[model samples]
Target: MSRRARWLAGACASTVAVGLLVTGGALATPPQEDSDRSARTEVAVGAYLHYGSPGVERMRELSRWLGGTELRAGHTYLPGDTWSNIEGAPDSLRSWARWRKAKADRLFVLNVPMLEHNEAGVPDGRVAELIGSGAEGEYDHHFRRLAERLVALGVPDTVIVLGWEMNGFNYTHRCRPDPENWQRYWRRIVAAMRSVEGQRFRFDFAPNRGGDAIAWTRCYPGDDVVDIIGMDSYDQPPGSTFREQVTQPYGLQHQVDFAKAHHKLISYPEWGLFRNGDNPDYMRRMLVWIAEHKPLYHSITDYCPHGVWQCTKNPRSARVFRELLSAK
Candidate 1:
C-alpha cells in the first residue's frame, strides 16, 4: 500500500483563523536566542536525522558535516500502533530527545497519530464517527498524556504538529469530509494539552504545499488555537518549476503570507527532493528562499532515496547543502 493508503487503512480517524490572537503561552518561542533576530522571521535549520540511522551518532555526524550543530529541530513520528493514553514518555523517544539535547537545543516536530490505524479497509463513516464524537474522549486523553509525558521528559515547548497534512486527501486525518468536526477536535486537543500544568507546548497548524485534496484554508481552526503555521512541501509534481511551486495557490508563498498575516511563526517541518531527485538547483533555491523568508525552523527529511546524509541520491544537492550550511 502507498504511504497514504497505509495511513488510511491502519484506522480512519481524525486549525485556524489568522491573527489577532497570541500563542497560548509566552514561553512558546524558539529554543535558541538570536538576539539580533526578530521572532516573526528567524531561521533555525535542522533535519530528520534518524530517518536512515536511528541514533545520536548519525545526528552528530550530520552536524559535523554541515559545519554546525546538525539542527535545532529534530522531526519524528508517533506510529499508529495504538490510540490509547500515553502513560509516560516512550523510552525510545526519551532517549532520542536526550541524545539530541546533548549537541544542541532541540525542537521536536512530532507527527502524532489521530487514528488507531490507517488501513484501507477502514470505512470513512467509522472514521467520521470518531471525529464527530471527539474520538470518544480519546483525543483529549491522548494529548493530555502526551503533554504530561513531554514535560516529564524535559522537552517542554515542543511544537506539536497535530493532525498535520489534514487538508491533504491521502492521510486519514483529511479535513474535507467533515471539516467542522476536525476543527472542533483540534481546538479540544489544544485546550486539553494546555490544561496540563507545566506543559508549554506550541501547536503547529501544517498542511501540504498545494490544494491537492482540499483548499487548506477551509480547514483553518482559528488563530487562537495555533501557535505556528507549517508546511510539508516536497519537490513533487514532476515538471513544475521551483518558482511555480512557491507561487501556486496554496503553495509555500501562500503559507508564508498566511503565517505573516497572523503574526505566527512559519515552519517547514518536512521538505526535500521527491519526484525530482538530485536537483541541485532545487537545493540552492530552497536554501536561498528559506534564508530570505526566515521561518522559525525548517527540516530536510534525510532518509534513504530522499535524504542528503546517508543516501547519496543527490550529490549535487548535498554539495549545495554543505556549502550553504557551512558558510553559516
Candidate 2:
C-alpha cells in the first residue's frame, strides 16, 4: 500500500462510529464504509515453537502435539528458551522461522526478545541499564540482527511481534515496573529495525491482557510503529468446567476492544487451557469458542516453556491440550 492509502485505510477502518446522529431529525444512521475501509482483523492459527531438534525436544513435542493443523498456521517465541542452550539461540530461532515459512500455509508470528530480562541474563537491577549510558546499544544491535534475519527468510514485517508481554510482572522480560526505560528502549529498537527491514515486517507490540492500557497511556510512538496490538490470555485452571472457560472469552474481548480503540489489529499471540487437557471433548469446545469469538486473535500460541513447567505436568491436562491443538 502507498503511504496515502495506508493512512486513509487506517482512518476509515478505525472510525466505526457507534451510532452517528444527525441534527436534521433523521434516524441514527451508521457511518458508511468508504472505498478505503479495511477489513483486516481476521484470525490466523499456529503453534508457538514448531521447529524442534534434539536440543528443543520438549518444545517439539508441544508443537507436534498441536499437530499439522496448527503447524500450518505459524509460531512465535523469544530467543531465550529457558536458558537450556543459549549457544544455539540464533540458529534455533532461525530453524523455527524456516520451518514455519516452509511448512505452514500462513506464518503468522515470529517473536523477538526486546527487553532486558532475567531469562536473558539481565538481573533485576539492570532496569537502569535500559536507556542510561548507552547500555541499550548492545540490545539494539541484537534486535536489528534478528529483524534482518526474519526479513531475509521471507517473513513479512507484520508477521513479526517485536516484544511479547511488556507489562505482566511474571515474565523476566516484563517491563511494567520500568515504563520510562521500556519506552525509550522500544523507540530505539523500532527505529533501528525499520532501518534494516523497512515495512516488509509489520511490527507488533504485545502486552499482558491488561498491560496495553498502561503501555499505551505512557507512550504514543505513532500508529506507524505498530502493525498489530496483541494480548496474552488463558482460561481458568483445570478445576473449572468447560462453561467456566467459555466465560473467559469476555476478558479477551477487553483486549480486542482496546486494540480497536487505537485503530490497530488485535491478536492472542499466546493462549491455552490448563489442567483441562485430559478432557478432549470439552477442550474441543473451548477451542471452537476461542476460534469463533476471539476472531481478532490472529495466532494461538499453546506452546511455551511455562506449559511444561506449569500446565502439562498432569496427564489429564496434557490430554486436554492435545484435543485443543488437534482440533480440526
Candidate 3:
C-alpha cells in the first residue's frame, strides 16, 4: 500500500471541557464576494465522534467546545467481523437512529464493509473468489437486511459509505483483487440496498488519496449508483508538499474534477494529520480546501495521528483545525 497511517483509530474519549475553550478564537474572514450567504454551501461539518453511542455525547461536547459550531454529520462503521454485524447490529443502530431522528438535518454516515472478516489479511486468490461470489449476488441478502434495518430504525436517508477506500489494498473488500468483479459487486450491493422499501440512501464511492493499488476510476461502479465522490486523504507521501497532494494523479484535484463531471457532490469521509506529525500548515491548507470545494459532508477521523481534538500529539494542528473550522 502506498498510503500510510490510515488505520481506524480506537474508541476516543475527549476530555476538553465543553463551552470553555476556543484555542485561537475566530479566524479573520475575507470580504464576501457575494453577500447572499443563503446561496453558499454551508457544508455539513463533522468529525468521527466514535464507533458507538459515546460518539453522541462526544459530538455534544465537541460542539460546545467549538462555540456551538454545528457538528451536523455523525460518522461510524459497521463491525465487519461477521455478515451479521454488517447487517447492522441493534446496539449501535438504535443509538445512532435516536441521534439522527432528534434533528431532521443531521447527516448520518455509515461505512459498510462489503466482506466479512474484512481485515483478516485474506490473500488475493481468496479475495478474487469472494468478489466473484458477491458479483453473482451471493451476498445481496445481507445488504438488503441492512437497508431494511436502517429503514425500520428511522434512518432511511443515511449516507452509505460502502467499501470505503476500495482503491487501496487494506481490506478484503478492496478493488485490487479483481477490478471487474469489484465493480460488479458494488453495483449488486447498491441494487439490493435500494430494492428495500422506505429507504433513501446516498452511496459514496470513497478512495484513499494518491494512486494506490489501482487507479480509483477503474473501480467506479457508475455515476448512477454513486451519489458522492469522497476521499480518505491525510497529510502523507512523506516529504510531499500540499501542492503536490492536490495536483498529483488521482489526488484531491482529480477527485473534484471527477465528481463535477459526474454531476455528483464530493466529501472527505476521512481526513486529518498523518505522515507529517503536528504539521499545522497541512491542517490549515486542508481547511481552506474544504471551504473552497464545499463538500456535501466531510468528517475528520478524530483519533490519534489523524485527529486534532481527541488526540494529544498534534496540538499545533489541532489549534489550526479548531480555529479555522470554528469560524465557519
Candidate 4:
C-alpha cells in the first residue's frame, strides 16, 4: 500500500488525513513568515525542573552555563512559580517566564495542569467523559488560558510544546486508542492558542516511538495539526552499548521518516541516561549521538536527581551535561 494509504488505514479515520492535508497542515501554525528578521531555527538543550527549592538556584546556573554557548532554548513545567491562582500556579509560571526571558530565547512545556488535573491512565473515565461529552470547547478553554498566560508573559511563538508525548502509554490514558478524542482535544487547544498568538508560537505533538508503527499511526492527530514529529527515548547504562540502547527502538532516521512523512520538524524533547551498565562511558556515548545526529530541536535530560537541592549532582550525567552546554 502507498504511504498515505497506510497512514489513513492505520489512523482508521479519513477525516484525520483530510484534516491533515487541509486546515493549517496537521496541527500547524497559521503560516508565520520565516523571514531573516526572525531568528534562525536551532536546537536547544536544557532540563525539566519543578518549582521551589533548588530549582530556582539551579535554573539560574543552567541558564548561565548555557548563555555562554549556542544553546537555543530551555524547557520547564508550566506556571513556573511566577503566576499563581490557588497554589500560585500562574504566579509560578510567570516567574519562570521572567527568568527564561532574561536568558533563553525560547521555552517549551512538557505538560500542563489542565491535562494533568484530569489525567487518568489510558482508558481513564475522565478521558472517556471528555470525549463522551463532546465538549471539545471546554477542554480547549483550559489550555487556551494557559497559552494566553504564556504569551502574556512574553514567551515567543516558536517555543512551547503543549502536552508533549501525550500519546505514550506511560502517562494518562496509556495509549488511549481513541484518535478522535485525542485529535479533538489537541486541535481545540492548538486553535485556541493560535487565535491568541497567531503564528508567533510553535507547537509540537510529541510521542514515544516504541517501534509500534501502529502506535504512531494509531494515535496520530492527523497530519496538518502537528508542527513537529517528536519522540522520547533513552538507553540506560549496564545493558547494551549507548548506540544500541538509544538507537534500537527508534533511531534518528526513524524520527526523520516520521517527520518527512508528516511534513513536521523533529525533536527529542525528554531523554536521559539512567544507571543501566557502563557508567561514564555510556554517558559519553549518548553525548556522541547528540553531537553526531543533531536530531533534536533542543534536548533535555532527566536531571531532577530525586531529591531537593540535588540537581547537577549526578556526576556521571553531569559530565555529559556540562559537555552539551559547552558545545557550540
Candidate 5:
C-alpha cells in the first residue's frame, strides 16, 4: 500500500519541523536596488490563512499588530483544489494572486501538491500508475499552463514548492518507496514550468525537517532544477528543545549545510507551534534563531490548533511573536 493510504488506515506520530533560522543578529534589510545582489540576509514574514472568511484583511491586521509587512502568503494548492484545478482555467490561482498582490508586492509561496487531495484512500498501484509512464505529458501541460497563468496574473515570480514534505510518509507524494520516479517527476515539472515563455518562477524543494520517515536528501533532484531548499519545521515529535531540534540528524543544521553545499538560498514555507502547544520559549528561540541564521523567507501557519493569531490558543507565544517580529 502507498504510505498515505496506510497512514489513513491508522494514525501515526507527527514528525516535522520547518523553522528557518536567521544567521547573525537582527533581520537584514533588502538591498536598495534589484541589481545590488550583495551577500546579505533578507527575512520576509508571512502566514498561511484560513480560507475565504478572514481573507487578506486578517493578514493586514496581523501585520499592523506585529508592526511589519506580511510580505509573503504561504498558500497551498492540491491537484483538484481551487488554485490547481488543472482541468479548468486559471481563475482561482489568478484571483488569489491578484488579491495578494493588491495588498503589497507580495511573494506567494505556493505549495503545489502532486496528487489529488483525496488520495489517502488510493491504492498503491493506482498511485504508481498516476505518477509513472506518460504522466510527464500531463504534468508538463498543467504546470506550463499554470506558469503562463501566473505570469498573466502579474505573479510571474511566484515560488513554486512542488510536492513539499515528500520525505514524510504520510503524503501521497512521499519520496520513499519510489525515489527515482519522484525525482524524475520533480525534474519534469521544473522543466515544463521553465519552458513557458517569459516565465521567471522559482522552484523550491522543501521537505519536513529530521530523518523521521526518510532522509530528504535521498530525493534531491539536483541543484540545477531547484532554486531554494525549504523545510516545513515546527516544534514536533515533542520534548526536544530548540537546540536539539536543529542539531539532530537531517535537522535544521543539516538542511543549512545541504543548501550551502548546493549554493542555494534556504526557506521555511511552513512553521508554527505544534505537539507541545503554547510554548512561548519556542517562539522566542525560533525568532532569535531566525534573526541569527537569516533565511530568505518563512511563514507561520496561522489557524486553529496551530495558529498564533486570534490569541485564544497561544496568547503568550503570540505576544512573543509580535515583539520579536516588530523589533528593528
Candidate 6:
C-alpha cells in the first residue's frame, strides 16, 4: 500500500545496524560460554552437615542425596567450651583444609563464639562485665591466636561468623546487656584477626531473625569492619506465616534493606524449619525467598527440629529441600 514508506523504514534499519557494527554496540549477542558460566555460578548452597572431618565427607553424601546439588560451602562451629579448642582445633581443620584446597571456588564458613561457655546461662550482669573487659582489649590475644591458627591450618580465606546471634538470649555474647561494649569487642576481634599475616578472611555480622533481646541494628560495629550482613532465619512461633517473616519490622525484608543501605552483600548462614514443625509450606516459601534474593551463600542448620536429611522428622519439607536444591 505504501512502498515509499517501507523503503524508508528498511533504509533506516540498515543504517542503524551498520552504525552498531561500526561502534561495537554492547547490545550484540554474548558468547554462549559466558551465559553457561553464569548459570553455573548462580546458586552457592550448603548445609551444616557435622562439626568435624565427618562434615567434609557428609557434604558429598548430601550432594548425592540432592541429585548432585553442589555444595560450595563447608559450615562448622568452633567449640565454645574451651580456648584451646576454639583456636582452630586440629581434629577438623586438616580435613576441612584438604577439602577446601581441592576446589578453588569452595568456601569455608566458621561460627566463632566470642567467649568460652557461650551458652552456659551466664547472668546478664556477668555478660556485661566480660563484654566490657573485651572492649578494653583484654581478650585481644585470644582472637589473635585463633587467627594465627587459621592461617597455619591453610584455610586463611574463611568466612568468620563471629559472635553470631548476638541479639538472642541463648548466647552469653547477647548484645542486650551492653550494646556499646559488644560493638567495641566486635571491632577489636576483627582488628586482631585482620592483623594476622596471609589471612584473607571475611567477617559476617549475623543476628538471629526477629527482634529478640534487642534490635540488632544497635550492635553493628560499622562497615569498615564488616564485609557481609547475614541472618540466621528459622520457621518459628508455632503459627506465624512466612508473610509475617517478610513484612515485620526487623524481619527478612528489613535485612535485605539494611544490607543494601550499608552497601554490603547479604547471606543466610543458617535457615530451616523450627517451631512450626514438619511444615512444607515454610520450606517451599524459604526456598523461593532465597532464590529471589540470591544471597552470597546459605546453609541450612541440618539437625533436629530444623533439619531434613539428618533429621527424619520433616519428610515433606525434606522433599521440598531436595526438589528445589537439586542440580538435576
What C-alpha lDDT do the candidate models reach, one value each? Answer: 0.68, 0.48, 0.81, 0.48, 0.66, 0.79
Q: Which residue ranges in model 1 land beyond 4 Å of their true spot?
A: 1-41, 51-53, 85-89, 100-105, 119-121, 135-138
Off by over 4 Å in 2: 1-42, 49-70, 81-89, 103-105, 120-125, 131-138, 156-158, 170-172, 197-199, 211-222, 236-250, 275-289, 293-328
Q: Lowest-scoring 10 consecutive residues by lDDT in candidate 4? A: 2-11
293, model 2: CA deviation in Å? Answer: 4.3
Task: Tell me, by lDDT, which candidate is best.
Answer: 3
Write down the TM-score of every candidate.
Answer: 0.82, 0.62, 0.89, 0.68, 0.81, 0.87
Instruction: Give me the candidate number with maximum TM-score.
Output: 3
Expressed as tens digits, the lDDT of each residue in 27-85 for candidate 4 is 32222233211222334555544433344446556656644444444555443112232
TM-score of candidate 3 to 2 decimals: 0.89
Task: State the lDDT at 239 in candidate 2.
Answer: 21
Q: Estimate the lDDT of model 3.
A: 0.81
State in Å the error of residue 160, model 5.
0.5
Off by over 4 Å in 4: 1-41, 52-56, 63-71, 79-88, 108-110, 113-126, 132-135, 156-158, 173-175, 197-199, 209-214, 236-240, 245-252, 275-278, 302-314
Query: Which sections of candidate 5 miss by over 4 Å?
Result: 1-41, 51-54, 68-92, 99-105, 134-138
Q: After superposition, how far is residue 87 of candidate 6 from its true place, in Å?
A: 1.8
Candidate 6 to truth, TM:
0.87
Model 6, span 17-63: residue lDDT tens: 21221111123332244433343476478888777778888899998
What's the candidate order when arranged by decreasing TM-score?
3, 6, 1, 5, 4, 2
| lDDT tens readout by residue for model 1, 68-90 | 54466667666655665233334
Residue 11 C-alpha lDDT in model 3 = 7
